[model samples]
Target: MSSYYGRPVLKEPVWKVPDVPAYLYLGGMAGASSSMALLAGLTGRQRLARTGRLAAAVGATASVGALVHDLGRPMRFLNMLRVVKLTSPLSVGSWILAPFSGLAGAAAASDVTGLLPVPGRAAGVVAGVLAPAMTTYTAVLLADTAVPGWHEAYRELPFVFAGSAVASAGAVGMVSAPAESAPARRMAVSGSVLELAASRRMEGRLGLAAEAYRTGRAGMVLRAARAATAVGAGLALLAGRSRAAGIAAGACLTLGSIATRYGVFEAGRETARDPRYVVDPQRERLRERESAGRGEVH
Candidate 1:
């Protein structure tokens, strides 16, 4: 078909902006709640522990809902369970998420009324272990897509998502738990440190994959990500034992992480549609082919 631009115009996601807001809410909740669950298990705070566990369960449950709701056919989401495929990240993720959700729910449910006896503690342990991936998988989910910026930022994206998750969890601690949440502050601090370290590594570590951090909308997003992750992480540590400071740090991380995710999504779409992503790479391939042809003839 003929076109004014001779190509597809850039567009936003197919889903309604309102119908499916980004996974920010759920991702953050899951990340933050895990830390709380850990704190509960470690510190022996029954009520907050239960609360965190419940939060994680609720967040994971809702996130899955959002993901399916946003799909072209929400009912078809279950089709992923029929078979296992290692080659497909989505398949792997579906499997990973399945048990994680169950464990998180079990832990949360167990915590609610304190009825698990031995099984509840075991469930909490399981949830705590998987918490990291629960937060990090969203990055993998995005990277697995054909989306350019997301795939490009694969290495760093995980770290970015991780940082955001940690920060978010800290926020939950600050808000729902208690002023005496010493461990909550510590978890927030730990999360901040990990996020900062990972993000810094992201910028210098990956090669061409790192380009997502350097140009256009991606650049702006990465810059903001660095600032937020840095400040939030730094401040969270400094905020040690202060619920207010901890919460603020959590909020900072939350905002920064959200911006980072949105920016990433936007950048991915930008990269996908732009000819450079497809054309330039192929141009290099063609040149290499021509050079090889001449070499064979000579």
Candidate 2:
């Protein structure tokens, strides 16, 4: 089979834009929020804890809805549970998300209703343990795929996603919780720094494969996202003094997080459409194998 630069050798992702990325964004937000909730609750910051719990519950539930909508059939989503596929990230994610939604929801309800404190705390602990995994599993999911952009960039995807998740959760808390949320502000700044640095390093390492991040539609979106992240982090640093600044920081961080997801999704699509990305890597591996064989013979 002849592979052309413009033609796709692999099946293009069936996932539509905004939807799949939105699912990723929401899931990260949910997971991070759950973590924030646990920390706040343990620290006795009642208001911040309440906000985090609500965000966790709402984000997780809504993300499930988005995933189901993307699947196009609720029954199809159900069918996924007929058996366990250890190698399938989607399957693993489904199991994680299902229990997480319940735990987060129950915790949120307990907080809202002023009842079941013990169970709520227990659930929050469990959810917190699962939160980082939930935030990061999607990165592994994308990297395990055949898409050159995702697979080749595996080294950085988890950290990038985790940072994005932290920023997203912090942004939500900064906007909704009281001005005393120092942890939220710090999280926004720190996570943005981590995300931007990791992404830049990933692109630097990609060589020609980095084309997915540097040119075309994905590049444009990522550029905007990078700007938003930097500006947001700056605003978050200044947020200690000004309420308005905090709001602006929160808004920018949220936008940056969403843009990051969309940019990543577009980059994967671009990578899949380019034949050179797939071919060159395989060719190099083949050359290495040939060299090894000759060395063995000698």
Candidate 3:
């Protein structure tokens, strides 16, 4: 409720639209697709594995491009690799992205060219090992910032991100592989459930900060994401052997995943542009601490 000349109390994130959100969505998809590729390979679903690998490669390459573009210089990204700082999410994320891109590319090339079978499989395995971390690290990176909406939702953001990643990967699988790829449909349904549940829980728990996610551009995008995901999940369940239904479901899920990333990004920006979203929760925390102190004294 307070402001300096009616201006925001915190500096808004300088991250640009499309670039940052695209990076988030693509990185998540790449990571989860790598994991799916690993699973498909182990299960002897070679076609699905190949599709997953290719998707991962493409997503990773584009994600890195988006990141470099956002930074305004490719060397700026390289500079982040100068030293490893475990305490910094940006540093950790940089390390994760670099290796993930290389591994995903190697795996995809091997799958497509039918060469370097041994090394390619190894790269896929390693990429799969790093996939979970890659999918969720962006959430940590966002929550580490001062933005009220993102910071307040830290506990659920990783789950939300991971679910979105898996759903996106599943959508890719469904679109590229045959309708017989039951694993893809299963992943879509499960991932959508997780994403929606986590999002709802995050909003309910955020109290005042949740307003950022429900009252503007962020709200509209997220509402659309939820609708798409839910409908896609239902369609996937009823798709059976219908290729058309599967494709439709996949398209919806993919859009949902994209919207989720953009919506969250916008919510953080919204919170940063408002003083109340920053001050209210902080004041609440201080009051809570004071109340606890008095209780202890009594």
Candidate 4:
């Protein structure tokens, strides 16, 4: 509304409501759970492994449904499979999602169906191999967009997303598994710390474009995310003493992780809605380049 005319440089994301954010959270949880399942299986923690596998499968399934729903039609998603687009983040992400889902499903099936041992182990390994990509490619997808906050914060987004994913998956494990599995508690605490730190660093580094994170609705949501993460992680550290505490910690962590996803999404949307965020950064970049050029001439 100021002198810049209030027109956004980038179109606002058409992906609305629960679909996009839900996909982000579910995909993250699925990826982390798949990794946990593989590690637990290798380490002979059968109960933890089974829980992780089932969680991974369910998360992956729901994530796929969310993606399809977001696409507006099932046919569009099918059409996406017609080509392997190396340059398109969504295309590559779609491919990565497929095998990871299948592998996770097979691993989960082996647990409930008792359908042999070797295939389940093999699927677990394959899913684990793809888990990191599954968790991180969405960061690249969002960063590739023209949105100012997302593109500017690209360096830190992957770490933030990864940490959130680990926290969410660990929350699932803590809720479903016995307290004996210390890895779940450790992962929740460590991941929460990492998520909080990375988000702070990202907000700090974005300069003027980070206004969305400092003010308005975006700021409020992000502050809540920070509070939830801190309390959840802190409680998780002391949760070992009591089962009720463990459940509470798990619930808090899961809520925090979901809040983190929605907060980041909203911040980027706010940045896209306001022209100043987009214009100011570009103007600054141009000014810096001009200054360097003048110095070179001198």
Q: Which candidate is the best by TM-score?
A: 3
Residue-level lDDT of model 3, residues 39-102, one tens digit each, is: 9999999999998899999999999999999999999999999999999999999999999999
Q: Using lDDT as the measure, name the better of candidate 1 and candidate 4.
A: 4
Model 3, residue 158: C-alpha shift (Å): 0.4
Model 2 misplaced regions, further than 4 Å: 1-6, 295-298
Better of 3 and 4 by TM-score: 3
Residue-pair clashes per candidate: 2, 0, 0, 0
lDDT of 3 at 64: 98
What CA root-mean-square deviation does each model show from the true structure?
4.0, 1.9, 1.0, 1.4
Candidate 1, 6-85: lDDT as tens digits: 56333424643422335644755675686678767677786567667877888878877777777757667788888999
The TM-scores of all predictions, comma-separated, are 0.79, 0.95, 0.98, 0.96
In Å, residue 130's CA in model 3 sits off its true spot by 0.9
Runs with alpha carbons beyond 4 Å of true place in candidate 4: 1-5
List per-prediction Cα lDDT, in the order shown: 0.68, 0.88, 0.93, 0.87
> What tens-digit string does per-residue lDDT give for candidate 2 at 1-298?
3485556777778898667999899999999999998898788888888898999999998888998898999898788777778889979877888889899999999888879988987887898889998898888889999999999989999999999989989898888884557989988988999999999999998777789888899999999999999999999988888889889999999999999989998999888877778888888899999999999999
lDDT by residue for model 4 (1-298), tens: 3434656667889988689999999999999998988888788888888888998999999998999999989898888888999999989998998889999999899888988678887988899889999888888899999998899999999999999999888888888886455888888999999999999899999898788887887788788888888888887887778778778888888888888888889989998888788777778889999999999999
- Candidate 1 stretches with Cα past 4 Å from truth are 1-5, 8-21, 28-32, 43-48, 72-74, 200-222, 285-298
lDDT of 1: 0.68
Off by over 4 Å in 3: none
